[model samples]
Target: HTGNEWGTENRAELCFPQLFNTSCKKPTTPLSQVLLFHILMPSMSLLTVTLNLLVIIAVSHFRQLHTPTNILLLSLAAADFLIGLLFMPGEILRNTVCWFLGQLTCSLYNYISFVVTSASVGDMVLISVDRYVAICDPLHYPTRITERRVKVCVCLCWLCSVFYCYMIVRDDLSQPGKHNSCFGECIIFVEFIAGFVDLVLSFIIPVTVIVFLYMRVFVVAVSQARAMRSQVTAVTLQLSVTLTAKKSELKAARTLGVLVLVFLICFCPYYIVSLFGDEFLNSASASIVFYFFLLNSCLNPLIYAMFYPWFRKAVKLIMTLQILNASTYK
Candidate 1:
């Protein structure tokens, strides 16, 4: 029982003064850390929620934006929104104060965390597959990746995530507080095998699929670019239109490649720590990795804002409160 079993503390203050003998010491969170948790976390949460909500509104409100690819963005935005709305605040609450939310709430928090995370990962994989089809097999993409099929895949992704993560956290969900060693703590302890399986299914394999598909996509995209460039002098109006369309697809693959890259940068360390035994599971470095993982949700919408003109237009309409009166963004 390193000090971590009690949430990053090996200090003097008792978490529960009433049960002096059994109570763990509360961690002395620094003023900077407190300010960070108090000020920055809420701001991050609000920004995440607000930006992702704009994505949702933009994609859903504008019928012109309802392509299969945007549908996947909508799903990813939904998961990021939940992460901001629920998960970030939960971490802030548990860290800055006592776990007054109770055991059932904690279990639910962890459960939803897993579900949202798995779904986010699934969305990334789906996005990769979508891009792969769009770039590698462009002629068939329209028929292959219809809005209906995207919707079905989104639904199945969520269902499978729900079922799979349930198997991982079912014990804690049932027992409620089985993982907590003392009061004022909300701990998540998954079995080694389960954690490894999660690392493989949720992190490793999906990442492998995303990387591989995106690699093939980029290679094909680059080839398309070279072909278009070589044929630039002989371009007819129709060929120009065709070239422009291909360039659009290439740009999309580039943007989503950035998204997947950011997701990997954020998620890799967390799973890397998990790849180690339980000894490193609750360490301070692991805590940092966990925070890094959570930051991905906040950063995602920012990437959308940077890359997507529609996201910018939507944010403008949303901020001006004109979205209510608008018919479509375009």
Candidate 2:
């Protein structure tokens, strides 16, 4: 009777009964929750990938799209694309099922996740700086923010993300599953000191830089817009055209400011949770916050589609395969 009960328990709970004591238990989730997650997570992943891919193709295939600002955006989209394609699916699977992939795969996934996220934050900082220069120092913007310099900055951002994440997770990389307690589980915990450092570098510092720069950009942009409106009413035709261009730049800055604001709203909750410790929030609630964070990637391209006329044209061209024509770049 005891043997039969043990077998039933194993069948019901353990992910791998053959491994018995070493195996992890299967996650117990309600039918409604399971169905909801299955539908919701994959949809988020697909939308994120599809939307960011459009941005990637738009920036890469069109010669006219290759500017300093768009280059930063291209790098940002690439990181977001990876998040949707790789990290989201893995996160969904990890939460829903026993991890069957070996420990090394788990370690690498976490490492890449950190790298991509750090790169995304870095890209936002660069975008804010780009807008600040364009708005506050219009005369030098052309010479100061060139495509080559932007490309170099983007490359450096990615490299630093890789290096920084490696340093953070070096022990885990050296010995995969060192933090896991069972065969079917995958978990990594940063030490208190390391976690604190990560909080400052990854969350605090970047957010501070972004907020400060955008504040400056906002002030300058608003003042410039008011000046342009006033001058347009009194200026000669040549000066009127110049004011018109400045007004357009201010509009662009405002749109991108919206993007930055959305990013902060989505991002802050997750980091705030991290600061307090995951134990403070229930698992389900924490997962919801995380999904909200992931939702930003999907929203980004939608923002572009709504605000940028060029992105719409690029998508139309890409959909029709018109980009294959030799003169499409022209």
Candidate 3:
């Protein structure tokens, strides 16, 4: 019934992979590529979905966890949630060589993917900027980047994201053969520009700013730690007791340093691949690089677990409660 409907056919084909019996024709894909594209993709899709959802629940259930930093985390979790729930599943289904969800759903799917993913990346950049301000400009940080500024930044991020998504959706469905399967095809100019912009604004610019700000913070903090150690020695000599002076400051500095390092590890791969693909790689290579972006969602929760004690505690508690509840019901 939907031979010309790319969206519907694509979703149906992917959702029920066994049902789609059409095998490859030209230049058969290698077994390794098949495994990577079909099996690994679906597994990672489900894993990413579950992890991101957990992040959302972990943050949401803990009322004490509603600081500005976590608010940004929550926003990121939301973005990842949409990508997992709506985009990955839908796109995976589409990849299997059919579209079964009809034209309207196809358009909506594309829109949600762009908007949610873009918003998530934007949130990360904003968070880095927030940390930079907090660390490098401590005395005036509160005044410079207030609660109101955060709210405005978040609001504007979503607004711009929605606008970008709208453009994509419009471009998808507004073509000459609106009902044809090809309408679901990506817009190259839009995607290329978007990728370039995201690579710069989302990762490069933010990281540069973060590095510069943290360098200043590092120097100041090191000096302060030395001064604190001297003061502690004077007091300890006077009273003949030990003090853990500057311990928390040193810890905080180390934590921030580690955080920047992890952020670099998680983001740099995707952007590096992105820049390389845009400049020289073919479509297939670029597509693989694009999938690497999903790895960030997987790594993000891990980062939070490593760095945030509250997040780790909440995850453990929630898992325990679920286990007990399941046994009780059993």
In candidate 2 the C-alpha lDDT for residue 44 amounts to 86
Order the candidates by lDDT, highest first.
1, 2, 3
User: Each candidate: RMSD to true structure?
Assistant: 4.6, 1.8, 7.6
TM-score of candidate 3 versus the correct structure, residues matched by position: 0.69
Give the runs in model 3 whose Cα sits over 4 Å from its true position.
Answer: 1-29, 141-149, 165-170, 176-211, 214-282, 322-330
Q: What lDDT tens digits, residue by residue, belong to model 1 across residues 126-240?
A: 9999999999999999999999999999999999999999999999999998868887778777987898888889987998898899889878988899999899997589998
Candidate 1 Cα errors over 4 Å, as ranges: 1-13, 30-32
Per-residue lDDT over 137-238 for candidate 3, one digit per residue giving the tens place of the 0 to 100 score: 555766887656777888899999898667645655564225342433322223566667666666677678767767776786777667666776474463
Weakest 10 consecutive residues of candidate 3 by summed lDDT: 19-28
RMSD of 2: 1.8
lDDT of each: 0.87, 0.86, 0.62
Model 2, C-alpha of 282: deviation from truth (Å) = 9.1
Cα lDDT tens digits, model 2, 105-150, are 9999989989999999999999999999999999999999999999
User: Which structure is stronger by TM-score: 2 or 3?
Assistant: 2
Candidate 2 shows a clash count of 0
**TM of each candidate vs. truth:** 0.92, 0.95, 0.69
